[model samples]
Target: MTSIAKQIERSYSATRASAKASRLVAYGIQPASRMVDALDTHSVHWRQWQMDVVETPLLEHFPEGQRDALVYLSADSDTTITQLEPGKIYIVGAIVDRNRHKGLCQRIATEHGIPTAKLPIGEHLHMLSRKVLTTNHGDGWR
Candidate 1:
């Protein structure tokens, strides 16, 4: 991840960690004590997750043959997602730049040759603010 404003970075990290915790609880799994302990510190809460937390880039994590399974979710994408397909790995960039970095996720997806799609928010509900959704909000949609 590129260096962003410290405050935004912290907010993003906290949001992601909280989302992960929420997901674990939602699935009837108790979040580890280590994650709860880290909540009071500056560290992110990633230990409770049962899945492997790979510290590698997406390109390196997935082989070239499996690249087609990656689908990037971006608000700037022309295509809007109607339904998620099985076997596809949907990626939501956990970026909260307050509009300072518009289209950054889409650009990165393009660079990586990953297909992009936006949520069909406009077709479902009208909103006063931009259609961009927070990480937790996006997860709730699932």
Candidate 2:
């Protein structure tokens, strides 16, 4: 059986895979806003993986260099569900292992009719990228 965190991770990965084949875009919401800065300088193995695009930090618009996948990591305090667009997919993973505020984001998605996957625990950076590449894109902006 998969661990709770692994289960969440798998669910996200499966979602991303489905989206990639269908030409959909997906974003991974980071647990905290600080990840955004780290992602910009972080190394993503896009070339080695042969993926059209690799994970990325938040930007005004999705980068053209990396097509297909756009990973948007959100800060933990990002409570703006209104930013989501229709027909988009998003995987929200908390940066910390704590579950104190877990499911809050998923609940928000349900309330707005936005489809989302929730990771019970924080996942590694690479795992987060893999999840983003494979999930479907929702109608929302990161």
Candidate 3:
């Protein structure tokens, strides 16, 4: 993942933690400034600078496995349905067989006593990024 993607992921995790703790930490990637005039900008933007000096280095210290463990690969319903595994992270991508209600991939994981976190891809794209590649193009172009 690119630095931006990693930052976005970590930002989401941090905000989620802050929310659960009932504290308004306001930690995340700040939106780009919209002001047109560069000279009009007042006050030094210390967050990015401070982050580069302090926070960026801390990210490198986290174990590789921990980072990978935090990543959840979202896939289409059919893809998820077949690839359900214990101790693995995943998110719902697209619903393949809505009529059969096969989209509930979490149920399969639960039955096996595996911890699974399911995020609705359409609604929670920011939180869960889909990375699964498929041979079948949804629109039948293939």
TM-score of each: 0.63, 0.27, 0.21
Best by lDDT: 1
Which order, best to worst by TM-score? 1, 2, 3
lDDT-wise, the better of 1 and 2 is 1
The TM-score between candidate 1 and the true structure equals 0.63
Give candidate 1's whole-model lDDT: 0.59
**Which lDDT tens digits does candidate 3 get at residues 1-142?**
1322333334334434452321211222224422212212432342332122222221243334354432233343222333345544333222232336443544543443433443334442343334333222122222
lDDT of 1 by residue, 26-47 (tens): 1111244332344324335434
Q: Rate the local accuracy (lDDT) of all candidates.
A: 0.59, 0.36, 0.33
Regions more than 4 Å wrong, model 1: 1-45, 63-65, 136-142
**What is the RMSD, in Å, between candidate 2 and the native fold over all Cα?**
13.0
Q: Mind sharing the TM-score for model 2?
A: 0.27
Model 2 regions lying over 4 Å from their true place: 1-36, 44-98, 115-142
- How accurate locally is residue 139 in candidate 1, as Cα lDDT from 0 to 100? 40
